[model samples]
Target: MENLNIGQHISRRYNEELEDIRNRVLAMGGLVEQQLKDAMTALEKRDAGLAAQVVERDCEVNAMEVAIDEECNRVLARRQPAASDLRLVVAVIKTITDLERIGDEAERIARMVSTLVREEHSTRLFTQIRNLGHHVSSMVHGALDAFAHLDTEKSVEVWSEDRLVDDEYDSLMRELMTYMMEDPRSIPSILQAMFAARAMERIGDRAGNICEYVIYLVKGKDVRHTRVDKSG
Candidate 1:
């Protein structure tokens, strides 16, 4: 009887911890989304103030990641949960890492925006960069939504959007390359545009990682490197 009671108590505690972790992850996602939005806006408007704010606010995302990691560790040590509970804890750990990377990508975008603000460089590449940012931010938002809803199918759908981001990035690269080839003087701007495109591509990759974790939590399958049919 005592063991049964203890099991029930542990179960309750584990559930509470899971809920807390979910809330923390959601909050972290909110911060990352905001960072991406602010960075993109700063880039579009050439607002140095907004870019500076994004750099300053990145510390909050880093701090939340640490807190979430600590919480996951505490739960694992105390609860020693199995089945779905274990999956939840593991998924949260993976998801937070992706979120942190997304935060870093946002910071990189802001730094690039700072440069543009300082120099006021006018180029055709800005449209490509802005479109790439839009696609990446949309994927990030969808991935978080899939995580919140625990919809494996939606997560898979979100994962597929990474390809669109990649295609846009490739187009941006080709466009820049054409400019650099046409005019030797375009090298510096072309290089900067390439870096910004690469950053957005990485953000898309991280969003895809989050989608993979969500699918793993729901389907109990690893779909990281091997692409399986997610038509279901």
Candidate 2:
């Protein structure tokens, strides 16, 4: 039964590799979540020091994405996994791409924080932006939790939260426009606030993408373009 033993060994090794890749994806998710949180805090506190730290940490997130991608490629080349294993690799790749995009959005927000602080914008406007940041950050955290647990229900919930973020974004844009119209001198700072709001909205979108990937991984369904109805 020598051939049987060899087959078992190969199977175990392949399973182990899959688990390793899954762990790496979750670790990357944690980093992205922290990046978003730090960026939002920086904006709220108007702390350039914290914003700078968030920008620097983005490089680490980028490196993790590359490393995980390379490992996925290696598994595909060496193992030639099929069926469920193939789906897992594809999902991991998509999830990491979205995670990287989220990190990019976080960095954009941090840069805006730096500028807004230097410009000495009104504290009232920053307060509203902070509220928006909290909402988007919660979405990101929910998406990551869904992926880690392979909970499709939670994934759908996270996907639904994006609409709320969109509404908040639209409201913020209107407020900024009113500010600019009322006082031309505030245009520069209001413009920066608009950019920061856009970045936060994009981060919410990326989080929704991650949720879609999770649903795909668990259900073998593509829900990207279609409406997701949690209720039967």
Candidate 3:
């Protein structure tokens, strides 16, 4: 491992601090991923208790967000880091926000799962819902993997994968719309499905946002506010 080169005695402390921040961000990402898994399992099993637990654990995610933020702020204020250190700190700040939002989306999906358990749904719709979950979950995992590895190519790949999730969401909506049009009784289940799909779509959006941050962290460029010109 390379030393921080801040004179002699304090280099170890600096290295330790940086490593701790990275680990904390990874831990937060893991927590959000686990929350998504728990939410999906609860939906698949129709386990209200597990769904409620997911909702309750969202507070832990929020706390992790705050802690990460504070650590990043401290690093910036104390170290006055420049170049890659600056990029890493900024990336952690942005990435944690994305992770926190993903956690919220997971909780939202869990609540919808509870509704799905309460309401009766046709077999076909249930199968489609499961398939949608699988896609969104893969996107989440891909986004996190891209971030952890700092692979800009993988991040861009994940960003493009958002299109597939959006297409699936639109298709699901159209199917539900047809069901609602054909039978008025299907409206309630359709509404729940719509909310669930919307939540999953938002999760994909946030995952893309995380991918953008990975690009920023690696390349030291802000890809969020402006469009890139490829023809130059």
lDDT string, candidate 2, 180-228, tens digits? 9998887888887888899999999999998998777777778889998
**Candidate number achieving the greatest lDDT relative to the actual structure:** 2
Q: What TM-score should be assigned to candidate 3? A: 0.89
For 51-153, candidate 3 gives per-residue lDDT tens digits of: 9999999999999999989988998889898777777788889889989999998899788766767666634465667777877788788888887777788
Candidates, ranked, TM-score: 2, 1, 3
Q: Candidate 1 residues 33-152, lDDT tens each?
A: 999999888877778899899999999999999999999999889878666667778999999999998899888978877677544343455665888888899999999999988878
Can you tell me which runs of candidate 2 are displaced by over 4 Å? 1-10
Model 3 regions more than 4 Å off? 1-10, 225-232
On the 0 to 100 scale, the lDDT of residue 150 in model 3 is: 78
TM-score of each: 0.91, 0.92, 0.89
Q: Candidate 1: lDDT of 99?
A: 95
Q: Which scores greater on TM-score, model 1 or model 2?
A: 2
Q: What alpha-carbon RMSD in Å does predicted model 3 have with respect to the real structure?
A: 3.6
In candidate 3, residue 46 scores what lDDT? 71
Q: Compared to the true structure, candidate 1 yields what TM-score?
A: 0.91
lDDT by candidate, in order shown: 0.83, 0.85, 0.81
Candidate 2 residue 38 Cα shift, in angstroms, is 0.8
